[model samples]
Target: MFNEIEAIIGKAKKNKNYTQRGAVPSEEIADLESQLKIVLPKDYKYFIKHYGYCFWFGGVVSGLVGDNKRYEKLCCAIRKTKYYHDFYDHDSSYLSVPQQGLVIGKWAGGGYYFLFSQESERAGEVGLFLTETYGQEVSKFNSFTDYLSFLVTGTPDPEPVDVDYDRIMDIIED
Candidate 1:
């Protein structure tokens, strides 16, 4: 799984600067695999392996894009906890609860974004979340252990958006 995730990340980094219009780049399959540190389900691997650069937000915007249904199913299996619900309410901008087991949220500083895999845990097994960010920088998480450590102990990292609304409207009017 880790190997698959690494492959996805590698591809994303290679094309980080390339964008279409002004939207987030569709993450490369390699980059996604790298971040996940786990082999995606067979259906996902097949889609990504075959699709090449034409998958994800770059080509389609639906949750069904690239075998996300598998993850969605996993989310459905988990019971929503107070912590999860509260996180959703507090971060309304980034939280979407059309279903269960999946919790998406933007980090505080806006530098990073996350999609969590929610499920009931007994002791050592923890929920998994995929975090991605934009810009020229790349943040590192050596392993799932490292990623979880940051989630539990780190402060919120938010990116402040600085847009001149009035000026932008004037340009649009012209």
Candidate 2:
């Protein structure tokens, strides 16, 4: 297990009742991989296996799903918005490799943290893209755990009290 993931699990265990978004079956994961035509990072796979398909701290961090029709996945959100591509496609410096990873964690001001399938030193290694900022390029987050830690430190705001996780996937880019 990734040490960061262990820390994330530990922190969540210490902070709350540990409610999972829900379990994603192995077959669905495999189907997602097949559809994406890329191997998912191992840490992410472990995360899905243990943490399930929902974001942590309510809806702060997004999770990848095996099937979009059945559940919300990172790609599902990305596919809905061409904003990411429209804003960053011409900037080679920004690494517009939407095909290379999943948008697992979103940030304020249209920023997002993506897990790279390529151009990363390790599986589950992530980088941030600030869509609203100029020349922001990428902010490295060593691992998914690190991204979770940032969110944890910022606050443990449980999934928005009024937001329905089931229906929230449609508006991730909004």
Candidate 3:
């Protein structure tokens, strides 16, 4: 799965900002899970285990690696999750992120992409949340693989449907 993503990214003309670090050790992944108290999705774990952090196409896919000054401005999965936790606290009305949600990616334009952990039925599924809206999900995929595929390629797993505020609220309320 990750190989396919690598191939796609390899085709792109990398700019100076492109950074794709190497694989992380299993112990490091375990430690991160323990520290964050979150179980990353299997596909994401596989990607990080073999491909570390990635900054491509002007977006970022978080990972456990990257502690250098170069990545100071970058937010790993844990940091991004904590950042949103504060955002949710300060603006609960505009942030509808699930308690089980962990941000896995972010677009340069401020759109956050997150996945619900194993605790929720939404596990592995990727949901897009925009702060500009009432934290309503702008788009969602059946899985992280699908989301990554769409992010790397122009194709979406299934065409993205704009999730309305009412529908999103209904899901969250349940």
Candidate 4:
């Protein structure tokens, strides 16, 4: 999946004449993996290794200046997946791929959001997603790799609330 995302980003970068935006290069990703002490999911690693920073979401940091086809395809694909059904309804908007491991979504407050998991704790995932999607509005993470490190090892980071987990478990128990 990551490799495919990378190819798509490369094509978009070339065709659209925009500099790649808000992406962490592979080296940085590697360093992040090392710091966090976790192996990234194969699909996630594939994306960073091949595409550098571009992911399913593209228009955030780089400006709305890349290949629309690539962006559209990502949105379309995600919309069609079971993952979408599980986390989000069909009505949500595709946000941005803020970092290697996170995808952001915006929907009516009742709908759940999508998040691609890494080995790190939930706080790290939230932090990475927040920084990447919001950019300067949020503080920069200590390092791109630090985000990955948080995902894999789940170490040395604050715990994040698992809203989905809590809700689902509540439903099941009820």
User: What residue runs in model 4 are displaced by over 4 Å at the alpha carbon?
Assistant: 1-3, 14-17, 21-27, 55-174
Q: State every prediction's TM-score relative to the real structure.
A: 0.21, 0.61, 0.79, 0.30
lDDT of 4 by residue, 1-174 (tens): 444444445555553434332444566656645643444555445544443333322232211112344553233223322343443333223233323233323222222222334544533232322222221112223332333333233334644432334434444466
lDDT of 2 by residue, 12-50 (tens): 655553445456678766765666566777777777766
When 2 and 4 are scored with lDDT, the better candidate is 2
Measured on C-alpha atoms, candidate 2 has an lDDT of 0.56
Give the residue spans of candidate 2 off by over 4 A: 2-4, 13-19, 56-59, 65-97, 118-123, 134-136, 154-174
Residue by residue across 1-174, what tens digits does model 3's lDDT show? Answer: 667666655743254466767778899888777877778788878877876767764667777655655663474777787777677658646655677757877755666788877667888888887765666677788877777667666567544557576745664676
Error of 1 at 107 (Å): 2.2
> Per-residue error at 174 for model 4, in Å?
24
Q: Which ten residues in a row have the lowest lDDT in candidate 1?
A: 53-62
* Best of the two (3, 4) by lDDT: 3
Better of 1 and 2 by TM-score: 2
Judging by TM-score, tell me the better candidate of 2 and 3.
3
Off by over 4 Å in 1: 1-38, 41-105, 113-134, 155-174
Judged by whole-model lDDT over C-alpha atoms, candidate 3 comes out at: 0.70
